[model samples]
Target: MEPMRRTVWGMLAALFLATAVTVTGCSVTTEDPSYIPPAPLPPLEQLEKAPLADPKNFSSGGDVLSFITADRTISCSLTSARGEHVNLPYEQNGYSDAANNKLPIVPVAHCGLVTYQPPQPGDVKDDCAGTHLGYLGGVALLAPDTARYGECRSGVTPMEAAYGPGGTKAGPLTQLTVLADGQNLERNGLRCSAYNGGVACGNVSAGVGFFISPERYELVPAPAISSASPQAEGPKTP
Candidate 1:
């Protein structure tokens, strides 16, 4: 295996040494052997700007979420629920149909990445880094794919690497973006997806902040609610 350099980072999304590999969901369209690997991306600037204290504080840079590339814009406030994430991989909270509520049931169902989330132990649970990656910030690093496509979803297939605009690959946490939206957020111009030739994964994908694994946080039972009211008399109303 060879290592990538710095200059090769930014140019990746535009080059041509790309190849069309089949994945789970999205099928391959083209095959470009001319795909050339680009330079490496730079490190995320931790302190270049301060974290906006207010929740309303966002980059005036337009409707953008975290961890996406500079080209497109990621929506705001990524759903903490993985299932809702755009690029798939996140876990979706099962929705149910109402009976006679008359409140026209809001047609619902996790369409894309609104399916699954990283687990903790016996089951999958989103808890990035096992410790609360700082309620928001943490040392940026690429997440790697631990499983395959079909392994995650049954009918839903995993979309293989889409070698296009960005010359990246699809493996693990090769790219970084908001845990909420499946945007191609870039860091230092380095994106693992670009290496997969602009590959956008479906089904199973492990990349930077790909999940809220227990490896980062410890799972415990929910705190029980104590009753404040006094106990009623036994068999009174009967």
Candidate 2:
């Protein structure tokens, strides 16, 4: 009976020991060798607005004339001869003014040498009636409002000489100067003036010249100075 009891206790102890070992072996723990968390993104900010200029006081100088073909969609800035900063984005009705009523956007007529006819001194006023402005051989000619015979002379010879063989190309112009009432000014060897309701330009010596007005724009042949053919000369005093 004692031997049997001892054998039973020994069997129970061995079973418990085996059970403990199996439980310990079955349980497992593992750590990842290459796992990492993602980094956070940077914060965003709102953009600032551009500063604006005063519309009422924006009419700064330099003949602030707009071209007849000026594109309103294209924004730009220009300085006038008066040294004023005129912003084009703010301009309305072609004129960059508060009232926007001063300057008129009239179509400009660009005429070449072949199409132009030199006006006889006596018929200048009548011939240039509907004309606005004209250019020949790279020289800018103005139509006369009145036939001032002696005043109508070729301003091209001097201009062609000053600005090279073909005269200065008009492609580089950005702004046209508004001649003060009856004012005449010289620039780049050419003199421009407003006369008898017509705007005109010529060689300093009054040799070759052109005239035009707001209502008229034609590239008439610049009047010849002398009855004889024009001499290839530099600017002379008008």
Candidate 3:
């Protein structure tokens, strides 16, 4: 009887161990609490196919073109290196060419939102000192060559102000042409589309760009494209 009891206990222990091992192996895993996934890329294909904006909606000065959305909530300046160098407001102060000097003349698409929530503390870099960390308005810069697409310390409000005539931040708003919805502007390898949500701009060659609105902003990095993949073609200027 004692031997039989010992065998029974041993079998029960083995079964318990096996069950425990099976449960451990099949346990569900959870994502790391500290891990944050990247935002999804915008519909680049759709934006690329948008119809061209009316010429009257955009004002071109040689290589630089300036336009505002129909709602006047967002404005953009697209600059190409082809023509004479145009001094852009964001390029004037608090920006360094060292980060973007690789190309002889890189195309740039810079946009500003009239109203936007400031970036979170983690998103705000320590580069800006004394001045407020983030501003009520948000700005995005897409220099495809450098893969740069994000907000900088130089507030967009100041840029908007400078957009006024005579380089004054208080310059009249008439300087910027209005881009209606479902229309896009393409120039200097850069393209911008205005939608009901906001504006999307990108460097067609590099496959990088940004989407900005009053609620939030997203930076698009160049996607890895296999040779077999169909590329999104950049729009031509009208």
User: For residues 84-104, what per-residue lDDT tens digits would candidate 1 score against the true structure?
Assistant: 222222222232223333333
User: Any idea what lDDT model 3 has?
Assistant: 0.64
List, residue by residue over 1-238, the lDDT tens digit for candidate 3. Answer: 9999999999999999889989888665888999987653364654677887655446554456778777667778876532223235434531334544453666777776667766656444344455654333376666655333234344346545554334454443446777877778887667888874788887766767778887877667787667886779999899
lDDT of 2 by residue, 40-130 (tens): 2110000011122232232324432222111111111222211121233223223345554444332121111211234433344432234
Best by TM-score: 3
Q: Give the TM-score of candidate 3.
A: 0.57
In candidate 3, which residue pairs clash? 161-169, 162-169, 164-171
Error of 3 at 54 (Å): 5.0
lDDT of 1 at 192: 20
Instruction: Score each candidate by Cα lDDT.
Output: 0.25, 0.32, 0.64
**Model 2 steric clash total:** 29
Off by over 4 Å in 3: 1-41, 54-57, 80-86, 89-103, 120-126, 129-137, 146-156, 159-172, 224-238
Better of 1 and 3 by TM-score: 3
